[model samples]
Target: MNKPTSIRMCAASLLAGLSLLLSGCFITPGKFTSELVLSQDESFTFTYEGEIFFLGLSSLAQMGAANEEFTPQECYDEDTFEDRECTEEEIAEQRAAWDAGAETRAAEAKKKAEEMSVMMGGIDPSDPEASEELRRILLRHHGWDRVEDKGNGVFDVSYSISGKLTHDFMFPVIEDVPMTNPFVQMIIRDDKVVRINAPGFSAQEGDNPMGGMAGLAGLAALGEGASGGNGADEMPDLPKIEGTFSIVTQGSMKIRANNTDEGPNPTPTGEILTWDISPRTQNAPTALIAFGQ
Candidate 1:
């Protein structure tokens, strides 16, 4: 169990375990429409209407820990790299090693779950009560106009807020929920430059940090013998990232840089930059704006 050996195994199995080990804390966007309006006087209004997913890393880890099943170690020819029958002594030795470490691994997994629960405000994604708890938490905030749990860790929410750009801002800032990668961010510099980015708004493969948890859940379902052609249906229903994001800027502000494909389109109010996001989107939306003529 301790020695590194290349054994023939399904790549899905590796991904299943890796997802549990590395999924960690993260929040990502789902279907939604978002907009930001920036004025010449450094005032702004931001609105987001759509799904917000919260993945509980501890619950994922606990699932992994509880579902771990041992597969017999395989022996292979060193030179040819071909599978061969393992010796009786070798098999016994591997079993002994696995048994020796089982207790330690369980203890470590338990400790990690406990620590993560604290970090995530004791909300367990696997718990039936988690959705209501999350709704209550978000409703206590100012911007959240509505919060409805759509199951499978997805929440349909409507958030609208306005303020002067006196400091940096980030969305989905829930109280007691430890900070993870944000859905959207605006960083204001002392030089009167503002950088806007929507990291979790795109379907780019690696852009969503919590993306792996979906696979983890699917694998867990499969491992539990979810069959009869309904395994896919039984898998957790994670929301997809499909939405639109736009930014409106006053004419007095200078647009230094932006990644919009068609450039800014003129509107009656000012210039608007938009992105139609989907699974095909390869990059997240971003832009830079500077104050003063």
Candidate 2:
């Protein structure tokens, strides 16, 4: 589906406007589900020492992992990479595991999102000194603009501001406070946003400077961890999150989708394509925390 040139050109201009669409909604059956469409396909990019991570809001990793064992290998073929129909036992077990995982992740994510929202509310993003200072430290030398918002849980954010970036060195003690995970970044287009960017974190082979000592050093560290050592503490854990969610079928509003094949029939259709982030989270535990090691 070829989008009009105007829609493509006006994408950036549309980001800030769609952030609040979720804030204002009505709950009417067959009318309003009171759900918000993620305005962006992904969330903000948090770069630490050149490693880019995504922010996730859904405890999808936990839930998916919890339900993974229940899925028969036949349900997930490696060759064609197709998912076959599941048996009753698989469905029941997977549902139970997923349900349990959802409760844990949702509770954690909701609490964090609310806390960040409150903190942001207290701070004046408009204050020149405050905003500029925050933009420098938080966004890392990036300028920012507060995009207007609708009542939904979404809001516009602009980091590409004009002019130089300068700020004071005064640091607040509260600034050191740890924030929750799954920070979402929305992408907008054509006065409407339909995607979200979730943040994540990962740990790879730690920096080993010594040539022959490199592999040996890494092995020793692994030994320490195996011997109940805190070797892994030097790096952060992988954060899990829902990549981006959308309503396949529009309820009350008009459905404007691109790349959708109005074909005759296919076995499976719904492909919740998740972004393959840099660091992959563990696939075992259905419930886990990334912070505090």
Q: Each model's TM-score, in the order given? A: 0.76, 0.21
Error of 2 at 35 (Å): 42
lDDT of each candidate versus the true structure: 0.71, 0.27
Misplaced by over 4 Å in model 1 are 1-8, 11-23, 57-65, 70-98, 205-235
Clashes of each: 0, 27
Candidate 2 Cα errors over 4 Å, as ranges: 1-74, 77-83, 118-293
- Compared with the true structure, the alpha-carbon lDDT of candidate 1 equals 0.71
lDDT of 1 by residue, 88-140 (tens): 99988988998898998889777765765665677765566767987998998
Which residue pairs in model 1 clash with each other? none
Candidate 2 lDDT, tens digit per residue, 173-289? 124333332222333433332333232111122231211112223333433343345435421232222222122212222233322123111113222222222223212111111
> What is every candidate's alpha-carbon RMSD to the true fold?
5.3, 25.4
* Candidate maximizing lDDT: 1
